[model samples]
Target: MLKLREKLLLNTALLALVLILQLAGLMKGINTKVDSLLPSPSPSLLSVLTAFGGDVFLIAFSLLTVLLDVRNSGKLSRETLVFLVSAVIGLVIVGVLKVAINEPRPRNHGGFSFPSGHTYRGAIIAVYASNRWKRATPLAVLFALGVAMTRLLLHVHWFGDVLFSLLLAPWVYSIVKATQDSWLPLYRRVISRLGLGAFDVE
Candidate 1:
């Protein structure tokens, strides 16, 4: 397992690289070239898959996963809370960056698109799921990649947007994991005192 400091350093470096690329005016060229290569042959199919990365879908999925884990284990694990909390934080960060940077989407779309929210959600979910089930890592990765590709195919985001979102996943997970480890005991005590101890799984 990676420490929180290492994860932070890695993500910070990647973010710096993205900023440098943007400053050098290379993101546009890269986005245009990549978009040109991926023509949308089946919009409906890709759209359906892309929806899996959306806020509604991801939140619902997370809730369902937590419920299922509770059903099976008779307790809510720290992992579930970590996943949910990290996802919410990631979304907030992306939203704030979108507003602050005010980067426009591809093809004259109105909203900011410096970092793809759908891609970020997809990557975060993939990382969380893979951590829970190691055997599913490949599938999770493919799902994340597919979600990122759909954004380009649909011309909703630039290549740099999706790339950065993808890179942010493990970093978010690592941070959340570390936070959970540090705070779960206190959280458990509070919940247990309130008679909701079933959620106190370590």
Candidate 2:
């Protein structure tokens, strides 16, 4: 298994490369080319797929996964808490980046679009699922890719935006994993003191 530190370093390098491409205007050219290859709009089907990528859908999925994990183990697992925390961190980072970059959407939808939130959500869920359940990795990856493709097909996000978000997922997960051992005990202690020890994993 790859260590968390190794994963973090790899993802950070890839993110830096993507950012450099975006800043150099190369990502725009790439996005245009990729968009040109997509089929004409099929709003009905595209809408359904796009909905799967939404924050609401991802949050529900995360909750469902947590419930299932707890049910199976008969206790809240550290993995579940880590997954939730990673998702929140990813969202905050993406929100901040959107404000800082302030890139426009491909369809002129009037908001920052350097990184697609939907894509990020999909990728983050996929990473969380894959890490928690090794057997689900392939399906999780396909689902994430499908969501990324939907952004391009809908013309709501540039190719680079989706790509960057996809990379952001594993990067965020790695950060959480690398620090989890050090901080989780502290977190558990705080929760216990707050009368929330029921949620803490054994």
Candidate 3:
């Protein structure tokens, strides 16, 4: 568990690191270097691999996590709620940054791509799964790295973008964990009062 002060400090440091990397023009150099070394996989195979980090997969995965908890615990669990809320927060953060930063992709295709959304979701899954299952941390980290690599191979994001996702995930998770104690009970009470007791974690 992270204390609030620790979480704040960590978040500030991450933000500072990414900003410095961007301002120093190191991001473009790294992206170009990585692109030169890594060969893009076949389009069909890349499509399938990248889907693991897309919206459909993540939504299904999130619902499945909550449903499995319901099956075993007979109600929503606080950990599942924390995961869901943190995921939502992460999405919002990414969306706002994408618009605000307006950074173009390496491929110069469509969408603004400052931070890789696919990598962000993958990292979030890694953090949540590792918290729930200590033994799975290595596999979880590999999965997240795979997602990050896919974004680079697809030319949809810069190296720095995915790097930021990797940093942002743990920082977001730490904040969620640190603040959960204050919000969980209020969430429970609100859901209970709304006659949604089955969804209540408390």
Candidate 4:
């Protein structure tokens, strides 16, 4: 018994499934192009978006999400925590894998090339959209996809890097949601102990 809105959203999500699946082609030079024609994010735009610092946009967005929770009287949205935790988990997983595997980047790159951070961030943004604006999920996802494309076109990261993040976003989000559901009381306790009483919420 799905409402029209839910049905429409489900349909769109299905389409996203297809496209995201297809992006796997670029994950590890797996049927990928050494000379992909895809345009990268514009240099100026890259300068703007990638400026600040390590995951600057992410930090800003994460902080904003936290502030929004405060404004909402400490009632952190399940979606908000999911998005943040997913991104963080993705980062941590990448680090763990990098160290354990000692995986090298695509030669001459600054970091490992398995999963792309840009693509992962893009996917994370889409995860956040799912909780906040389900109807606009597709568009938000496209923007993230665009960021992945920019990374390749600009040659900052390799295909595998882009592919990894693309794959990681949704998975991390699910993990975050599951983890949050299982640990709400813990979250509540931590918040209570933080002396955020006025801003405390579930």
Which candidate wins on lDDT? 2
Q: Superposing all C-alpha atoms, what RMSD in Å does each candidate have to the true structure?
A: 2.5, 1.8, 2.4, 5.6
lDDT per residue as tens, model 1, 15-105: 7798678657778888889877777677898889899899889979987987887888988776777887789888888888788777889
Structure candidate 1, residue pairs in collision: none
Cα lDDT computed for each candidate against the true fold: 0.84, 0.85, 0.84, 0.64
Q: For candidate 1, what's the RMSD?
A: 2.5
lDDT of 2 at 115: 88
> Which residue segments of model 3 deviate by more than 4 Å?
1-12, 23-26
lDDT of 2 by residue, 141-191 (tens): 999999999888888888899999999988888888778989888988887
Off by more than 4 A, model 2: 1-5
lDDT of 1 at 77: 70
The global Cα lDDT (0 to 1) of model 2 is 0.85
Return the TM-score for candidate 4, rounded to 2 decimals: 0.72
lDDT of 4 by residue, 47-67 (tens): 565432138777887888878
Ten residues in sequence with the least summed lDDT for candidate 3: 19-28
Q: What TM-score do all the candidates reach, one by one?
A: 0.87, 0.91, 0.90, 0.72
**Superposed model 1: Cα runs more than 4 Å off:** 1-8, 23-25, 189-195
